[model samples]
Target chain A: MATSHTTEAVNLPSAVQERQRRAKFRRNMFYLALLAVGLVAPFVAYPVFLMKILCFALFACAFNLLLGYAGLLSFGHAAFLATGGYVTGYLLASYPGLTPELGILAGTAMATLLGALFGVLSIRRQGIYFAMVTLALAQLMFFVFVQSSFTGGEDGLHGVPRGSLFGVIDISSNLAMYYFVFAVFVFGFAVIQRTVHSPFGQVLKAIRENEPRAISLGYNVDAYKLLAFVLSAALAGLAGSTKTVVFQLASLTDAHWHMSGEVILMTLLGGVGTLLGPLMGAGLVVSLQHLLAQSPLGNWVSVILGIIFVVCVLSFRSGIIGELSKMYRKNFK
Target chain B: MTMIFGVPMAVFMGQLTLGLVNGAFYALLSLGLAVIFGLLKIVNFAHGAQYMLGAFAALLGFRYLGINYWLALILVPLVVGGFGMLMERFLLRRIAHLDHLYGLLLTFGLALIFEGTLINFFGVSGARYATPEILQGGLNLGFMFLPTYRAWVLVAALAMCLFTWFMIERTRLGAYLRAGTENSQLMQAFGVNVPLLITLTYGFGVGLAAFAGVLAAPLYPVSPTMGSSLLIVVFAVVVIGGMGSILGAILTGLGMGIIEGLTKVYYPEASNTVIFLVMILVLMLRPAGLFGKEA
Candidate 1:
């Protein structure tokens, strides 16, 4: 059933393929326009809020790299996020001489190691078991952080310095930090885009569609899955590290399972497989939270998100961008 | 005080009894999970929420309707079970043909909704549910004093788990349920109402969770977020036991709980994480779970 869908994509008619090529060009243009808007967005909207949206957008995109492309639903992604945040936060707080870039890199490294370990343990199971295993492992991490002195127990690591970028440009300024975040986000997004179009991604897709067939075709499916999981984890870590710098705090909330669910909500809401879907989803969710924070309805955010989840699973599984593209294809064709 | 492995006997016995009580809960919750998964082919993530609802239902019954403990015990499950049936009819049935993961996600969302709504009303601090007048006191068990309420919980949960095992494993209806699990289309060919059976099965599974919840209310403060954290542990327990065998789920749950309790006595720091550590070891050694048939 999965193979047929991928095969259909591969075996498209030349005329239709040409149309798809044109659509891709149009989509690229749309992305460029969106980036332009984002660059100028801080002038009108709160830069801090915009930064929050970008951090989450990158996180969700990293998550989508697994769930959308590789068909792996990891329910423990918050572990990587938290690991990155805590490592970065601890380094910047204790070692005042450490550069922000190094701290971020260090955080990402920790997340990569964690990802590699968790991915190796969890990749043995398929489907629901995989999700449960990741969750259990993440919960273990959560407890470790809670009980440890470094994480400050329930209060988390606070007052993490933004520090200088490469020992020259001071990133303590909000604008500098915002632009720094923007650069990191762009880099992360580019990496995801490049990874998706690479030869390795095709193999990952093959594994996702039909592991048995991929194995028959001489592909080591587990290796591919592990690699994808690690990549997803590292990028998610990058997002977490960037978020710590942006907010200047690394709290327990970042590593909580609810954060993992929030990222899933963003990815699922935006469009699971589409490149721009997670960005849109992150923006919408962040905005929803922002708006709701001022109203009595703030407490209802989970319920609302829950309703959205049910609605999405029931009838809108294709998501916003997925549905839009479908309509565009129908109308254009 | 006598010592066992250099630990005081009272501490050892206390932890052991506590472990057994916790084991009872794990067995009960995981059993319900296994049953639902056995027939429905969907992991009911909302099982924890249903358990929470069972506790809340009892609390509400007392606060508003003045219903006592014994009556609440009987009524709560029926109410929660009816809600589960409605969920199956409206939400679950629609996605019955999709991938099993969708069911997991759907129920996950449902759980969030239930938990969140409850939080909005009750707040996060949790409400108290007093132990019944009959089960208020403690028993001097010689080695260690045992709270009568906790002992009742252990016994009641064990009885419920055993009864459920017997009903599913030995009865004629259980045979049909098992047959349907193996091949629903074949069972339907024999004039069984597979759809109704599926709904009732889900309801029954949810009802069992609620039954556990009612038992837990007086032991712990009734709260909305209570189920979520406990749910993760139970998920680990379910994974360790494997979802395929009913007896496996029961044994694994009880065993893991004892292990956790023992950890508290021996290595207090590792108590929270021993189950997950065990899960990692189990995954490495037996990827399919201790009792599970290979997929």
Candidate 2:
């Protein structure tokens, strides 16, 4: 009976084709808007700051794809972020002529591979155990980085040059770097949005709501999750690589567990599953940091952030975009 | 000089002792984590921070209030535990109804606040907590020399663990606490005041962590970032032990600590990674953990 059902579903080409078309259209519209922001935003804000926000936004978006869609909360995403940053930083520092685009590709590819390796080990457990495992792996990485001489051992690789894009467009200019980062962020964000709304994404949501149902539906549940994990890791790598160039340095802070927490905060504060929420959240948090730095409240930033987190979890589970989505759904329905 | 496996036996014993000392801390910290997880169903990401708070509490008590080590040991845990109670009542209670992941995030946020506050006040470079005059020296054995304070820490931590184990496994109060953990509504139906029980359980867990901090201050430098670094290793210990079993948590922590020490003796580079390696191997062989029941 199961084999018959599986065969029947596999043979249904027209239905799948229709579903694919709708998914593609929705994804395309998202990319178009993201591209618009990437093109226009550099002129409006401090390009360096905008670049930072974009990098963090992409990082948060990647995180959301896993936790928001797959119901898998990874407590140690900094491991991947750090891994990508360090690899890219090392390559850029060692190889003088490495282009920004190629450096980012190398970093993203490395993160994707690491994500797959870590995913297989982590996905074995669910809920709390999954959080614990990822955190442990990330910590192990932290210690490795701490001892490795190439990472400059706590001082981190400093004064990293913003190599040109394809050896032509100099990313040294704040505006150029901002646009470059924005482009990567938009591309990464669009990929995440696409994956979450695709058939694969539906399978993930099914797993999140009810794993038994997803399995009974004859889906390869583990493979779907692994794919999501790798995709998330790749996007995170893109963010980290862009960040290395924008900041003109990659340091221990980028690889620290605190960075992982920061990314999670951005995702939660914005709206877990919403496309634009993470970008807004990244902006809000980075801006808040800037504002606080200019005031006595800088010391209390973490305290305030903590208070916000607790309140949001308790009273505002639906974040800014999440709340808007609810209102939109109500009116439309 | 006697040698074992191409290394001096003294060096081997020294690493073993250091590992055992670390194991003691791991056992205590993981024990608190297991208790919190068992009752609250939250991973208590703040456990390490709370432990750091305990050490800082001791340091502050001495620096400003003239509170000595002995008094601080008794007073710090109570203060930290009280803080934990307040957090549970005001902060954690609100999120108890949400997904367990929310609780984890909430605690994580609290950890950030705690660490940041400490850094702002004390700065990043660590403060030193001295060993009291009475416990300053070492005891000479035929084979090895043991620091008096180290011996005290090992003894005290063991006593605390055993006492906690005995209280929960052998007493009526423990029965109530365990029963509450099993079915809070049912226990509350019996007029057990389960809410208060949970509050006290969280306090007890936090207090245990504080107690470890007090013990650890003399051994390690007191710093704001201390908790964040140690939290991950403790999480690994909890995973290896399976949060389901109290004894498992304690045993795995101690065993892993010893393994870490042994690795340091042989291949110093892998010392930090040995626990994670063990976690992976355990997941492959027995996904639930050696003592953890299958979910």
Candidate 3:
């Protein structure tokens, strides 16, 4: 009787499981189509603008990896981004022989180290305290960069070399640079996707849902959180490093707490946990900023962004992609 | 000409006083933060912006309305506090049930909006508020000369902090506020207007920040970005003090300021970072903060 009951319970949701599987397959196909469109996007759109969106998209995705899945809200992500940018920028500018990929890797490594240190210090605190700790640490980094001459103080590290990739492809051309950025974004995106699907990601989600339960289940919750934070930071660094190569400059703007706020805004606007949400959000925000820069409303962008933030928090907490997916599921199912 | 730590005694005393003055602002701001956090469970990221508003309001009062310093002092907090109440009633009330972080994000956005608007109107160069005629000069305190306005700021901030502490810890209204903080639903069931209390508490907390801002107008340039720069340091102060205790916040704010002042004297380069360093240390030693109860 017990064996039969177990069999019945296991078989009860086969149809629902099958439907979910089908939906997931459809979603994967949709993502592939989106990728194909992105591959051809430079021909149709401004390569420079597309590159900007891709960089910020990667940054936002990295941030979402921690916040959406691991339940950690780091208010100091700009530090990682800045570290990555500055390291890569300094390396490329000072050493013309350094390959772009190597410089980017070095920057990412630096960010990973910084993230581990920050994570170790901050992960002990929960919630708001954690946020404050990260912010303070980031502020400390900001001051260091400001005081240090290597960062060029207020002027920033400029004229960073867009060195050849792997000593083969010249990425100095806008189109080439755009493609390179797209490739890096895809790699970063895939890494995030893989991480999310891994056993580790499942554990992180479990921790996010209920930390105490996860702890009771014998998972070292702090270790998982730290690993996630480091991974996110490294990815954010990668994005920043790539941005410096693309823009041929790394400035204080990348390091500012305001930049941190911007990433959070992008991630929120796109859809925190949804795979494509950050990309969409980053694209919209970058486009909005770009368009506003040319318009008389340039000064009003902050106000507009603020309004969007308030509106999002009050009504659309699920964000753009999140809302769309919810509706799609509701209507289709 | 006496030397202390290889620096002139006067210089040491001046820095100490300057530290105290800075501490007063820290105390006032952190007190407001602590009070609001106690009840709202939301870090009022806009507190700094509101403080900036207070300074700007004072400047505008003088510029447009011909209101002098004393009157602006009285008027600014009320205006800013009323704005805070409206924010609570209209905006914050909506997110009351959401995660605490949403409130923080909302206020952060509000801060950006307010700062941006202020920049558009006032320009980033900043404006000057004259030291009130009555408090313009300095008094020689034998060892060090003290600016009268600075002295007033210190005394006034301390008085306000004490008054807030007394009201919250000693009075019947304080009792109601504290009870609501403990359990708002229970307080509501017991016939206390918990929602109104929350609104008033937020308003009062914001008013405290404005009060500090008004006090600071003469000392610092009345600029849009002034508050955002100081806000991060005050956040460090809050973390070091722990958000749980009012007195702890006040004490930590004051102590950190003094420490920062001393750092300026001994290691000038480290002054800007001493508070954060202390914060890291505090987090290491006491993660809950010096006076905070374990979560």
Candidate 4:
């Protein structure tokens, strides 16, 4: 009366099963290769620069979780990032006894709260409204940061102490600090990976693909979205907090709308909906900015970035990784 | 000067005047946004940058080409609007099948390029845009004095908003536009050239933004950063007004501007944030917005 299907190995023919096994093997290999790069990158390059890349990579990954999977495009992500940076920066600067990890935790916690509030306000609206509302709220937060004395207004909270990770482990050394950042990046990435593979993550993806269909299937779509948003915000905050420790500075530029747009560019260029896409996008963009700043196109960075954005949206929506994967699938699948 | 609510009446009135002027810009900008959104279903994030270009075009024309304020007023909109049409044709047309968000992304990139290019050449300090000769001087009123240029900006902006509203709401061509907005494919089936209409609508909407920029050049500094901030506020205005009606956009923009001015008079610190606060409150109470119909 009914056909029975369970595991992929049993459900598919031997050839298909073999192909699936190869795909899984290939994916694991790619992850291992990426981890290898992560472990050795600090030694190969300037630790400070590598730390910057790691922080931004995490930030872009968090953003991709929302935009790529949750299908929610937020224009206020900078608020969470800035909020985290400022909170961590202030804690470390003013509270001499505050450990670095605690400062980061405080920042991530604050960003979580902000994300929750934002979710409550924004999740009611769909699509374009969500983006606009989020943007307006971010601008409001920007004004708050600009006017508030705690943010040091324009000067920002500078000269933050990169206190030791724990009471025992001193991380002021560039090498030590780079390792600490690497560990945190891996942790954040694992969390993202876990979330993306979970049942809740499947529901989020379902809602993204078809909200009405998801709702009809009895899922609390809003709650899933809100949770996803908060998680994204928390991770973004973690990135920001870590960056503050790495650079010993937190400023208005971090909270600026331009920062929000920059993250979007990274996600777009790296390839949305792909696990490694944002990481690649962040690395490419951060390096590009670093290179362009030294080149004759120094001040023209924004112009160049803008052109890239235009080209990406118009022609390369799949992005470098997305296109590569597409070609690979076309050839191999 | 007489006192009102423990503040000088002149100062209060001046703030109010400033508020109205801001509201005028808001109305003009959001009206264009509403118009464009009504059909395109895409919020033009480059609107602010385009507005800046309009102002810059006027300023550069005056400084370099000896074009007067009057001529720039006519010429800026055409030039900017024509530029908008080109963008629609070349850039937006390609991504017409994608998600609505891509339109926003494309425009945002355009904004960055525009603002960055301007900053590269002129720096951010901006330049003085002298008021037109005939529009110079102030008109004295019983309670306060009004600058001629500010008065002109208000009248001109209001006139433009009304004209646009009328054009879209009353005219036969407007009927077609409205029908298209209601259902484009159905209208296309009836032999309407929806693509051409879309191109023209984008141009017209962008023209309106440019027109407001021209009106604003004399009031505010003709600077690169000018339109960017104003664009955010206009975004709030659009959210509050809802893109449902052109009239809604105008009224919400003007109202928010007045409230902002009032806040300046009372709680000066909250002046910049009051409109955004209002937006949050509106979102909480009416998710569709005060004037926006739920799409």
Give the alpha carbon lDDT tens digit for every residue of A7-115 in model 3. Answer: 7657878887788678789879987998899899999999999999999999999999999999899999999999999999999999999999999999999999999
lDDT for each residue of candidate 1 in B1-295, tens digit (9 for 90 to 100) = 8899999988898899899888888999999988888888888989989999999999999999999999988899899999999999999999999888889989989998999999999998989998999999899878788889988998899899888889888998888899998999999999999999999989999999999999999988899998988889999998898988888988998999999999999999999999999999999999989998966
DockQ, cand. 1: 0.84
How well does candidate 1 score on lDDT at residue B38?
83
Evaluation by TM-score, superior candidate among 2 and 4? 4
lDDT of 4 at A306: 97
Model 1 Cα interface RMS deviation (Å) = 0.7
lDDT assessment of candidate 4: 0.92
Clash pairs for candidate 2: none
Q: What is the TM-score of chain A, computed separately for every candidate?
A: 0.93, 0.89, 0.95, 0.95
Per-residue lDDT of candidate 2, residues B80-149 (tens digit) = 9999999999989888888899999989888878988888889888899989889999988756778899
Candidate 4, residue B185: CA error in Å? 1.0
Pitting candidate 1 against candidate 3, the one with the higher TM-score is: 3
Task: Compute the lDDT of residue A58 as modeled in candidate 1.
Answer: 94
> True interface contacts reproduced by each model, as a fraction?
0.75, 0.77, 0.75, 0.88
Once fitted onto the true fold, the runs of candidate 4 whose alpha carbons sit more than 4 angstroms away are A1-19
Give the distance in Å from residue B11's predicted Cα in candidate 4 to where it truly belongs: 1.7
Quality of model 2 by C-alpha lDDT: 0.86
Clashing pairs in 1: none
Local lDDT at A1 for model 3: 28
Kindly give the stretch of ten consecutive residues in candidate 2 chain A with the minimal lDDT sum.
A1-10
